[model samples]
Target: MSFINYSSREINCKIVYYGPGLCGKTTNLQYIYNKTSSEAKGKMISLATETERTLFFDFLPLSMGDIHGFKTRFHLYTVPGQVFYDASRKLILKGVDGVVFVADSQIERMEANLESLDNLRENLEEHGFDLDKLPYVVQYNKQDLPNAAPIEELKNLLNPTNVPDYPAIATTGEGVFQTLKAVAKLVLLELKKKR
Candidate 1:
C-alpha cells in the first residue's frame, strides 16, 4: 500500500521491478538514476554481491511533481533476479504500489521469464496484492540483443492481459522512461481512486 504523509504532504509510492536472473532489472534502475537530475533522484543503493548481482534489492527514490498539493515521491526497487532469492523477492514486494516485470527478450530465456512472472504473481498473492488488479506493466528488456523474441510472442507469453508494455534496451535508455511513466501513471490513478 502507498503511504500518505499528511504533515509532509507527500504521497510515497513503491514500485518494484521484477524478472529472471540477468534480465536487466538493476540496469533499468541504474539507467534512470544516471539520467535523472540529482535534484529529482536520490542516491541509488544496491545490496549486491561482490560480483554485482543483486543480493537483496536495489532502491532509488525519485520525486516527480506535486499532484493536487501533495508531492509524489516514488521509491523504485529491483528484486534480486536469481531464482534462489525467492525469499528476498517476497520481502521486497511487501509494499509495492506498482510493478514492472522486466522480461528478458532473448528467446533462450523465455522459460525463465515465464517462471519469474509466475513467481511474481504468487508472491504478490501472498502479500495480498492481486496481479490482475495491481498497477502493472511489462518491459521487454535487452531488445537490442541478438535472437530477441518477437514482440507478439513475448506479449502472448508474458503480458496476456495486455497491460501497458514497452520494448526496451536499458543499457541505452531506450523506452525506459516510457515504461516508468506508464506504471507511475497507473499507480497515481489507483491512489486517486482510493481517495
Candidate 2:
C-alpha cells in the first residue's frame, strides 16, 4: 500500500529488491545511489552483518515528478537475501508497492534462485499480497559471468509468467536503471489506477 501525505502533497511508495544471497541486490542500490543527484535522493541507510551482507534492508528514497498534483516519492529497499533471514524479509514486505526479483544467473545457482523465488511468493502470501497481482519485474543479474545461464534458459526457469524481465549486470550498471524504471513505471501506473 502507498502512503499519501496530504499536508506535504506527496505520495510515498515502497519498492523492494528481493533475491538469493549475493545476487547483487545491494550493488544495484549502490549504483543507483552513486548516480542519483543528492537533491532527488535521501540518505541511504543500510544495516548489515559483519560480513557486509545486508541484515535488514537498504532504503533509498527517490523523489520523481508529480502525478495529479502530489509529488511521487519511491522508497527503494532490498530484503536480506540469506535464507535464514526470512523473518526480516517478511518485515520488509509489509507494505511494498512493487517488487523486483533479482535472480542470480550463474548456472550453478539455479536452485538457489528457484528457492528464493518460491520464498518470495510464500512471504508475500503471508502478508496477504498475491505475487501475481503485484507490480513486479524479474532481473537476471550477474549476466556477465562466464558460467551464467543462457537468457532463454533463465526465462524458462524463473520467468514463466513473462512479467517484464531484464538481463542485468548489476555491478557495472548494465540494465540496472532499465529494470528500476520498468518497475517504477508499473508502480506509478498502479497508483494512478487507484486514484
Candidate 3:
C-alpha cells in the first residue's frame, strides 16, 4: 500500500526484494544505495547477524524524481532469505505495494530457488494477496556465475505467470535499477487507478 502525505505532498510506497538465502537480495539493495545520490535518499538501516546474514530487513528510502504534482518516494526492503526466517519475511511483507522476486540462477541452487518461491506463494496467501494480482517482477541474478542455468529454464520454472523478468548480475549493478523502476512504475500506476 502507498501512503499519501498531504503535508509533504509525497507518495510513499514500499517495494520488497525477496529470494532464497544468498540470492543477491542484499546486493540489489547495496547497488541502489551506492548508485543513488545522497540527496535523493535517506539512511539505509540493516539488521543482520555478525556473519552478515539479514536477521530482519534492510530499509532504504529513496526519492525517485517526481510524477505529476506528487514526489514519489520508494521504501525499499529486503527480507531475510534463510528458511528459518520465514516468520520475519511474512512480517516484512505487510503492506508491500510491489515485489521483486530475485532468483539465484546458478544451476546448483535450483532446489533452493523452488523452495523459496513456494514459500513466497504461501506467505503471500497468509497476507491475503494473490501472487498474480500483486505487482510483481522477477530478477534472475548471478548470471555471471559459471554453470548458471539458461534464462529460458529459469523462466519456465520460476515464472509461470510470465511477469516482467530481467537477467541481472546484481553484484555489478546490471539490471538493478531497471527492475526497481519497472516495479515502482507499476506501483505508481496502480495508485493512479485508485484515484
The number of the candidate with the highest TM-score is 1
**Per-residue lDDT over 98-140 for candidate 3, one digit per residue giving the tens place of the 0 to 100 score:** 9999999999998999999899889989999888888899999
How many steric clashes does model 2 contain? 0
TM-score of each: 0.98, 0.97, 0.98
Which of 1 and 2 is the better model by lDDT?
Answer: 1
Q: Indicate the residue-level lDDT of 49 in model 3.
A: 99
Pairs that collide, model 1? none
Cα lDDT of candidate 2 equals 0.95
**TM-score between model 3 and native:** 0.98
Q: Write the per-residue lDDT of candidate 2 for residues 50-76, one digit (tens) a residue.
A: 889999999999987887799989999
The TM-score ranking, best first, is: 1, 3, 2
**Residue-wise C-alpha lDDT for candidate 1, range 143-186, written one tens digit per residue:** 99989999999999999998999999999999999999999999
Q: Least accurate stretch of 10 residues (summed lDDT) in model 1?
A: 63-72
| lDDT score for candidate 3 against the true structure | 0.94
List candidate 1 segments past 4 Å from native.
none
* Residue 14, model 3: Cα distance from true site in angstroms: 0.4
Q: Order of candidates by lDDT, top first?
A: 1, 2, 3
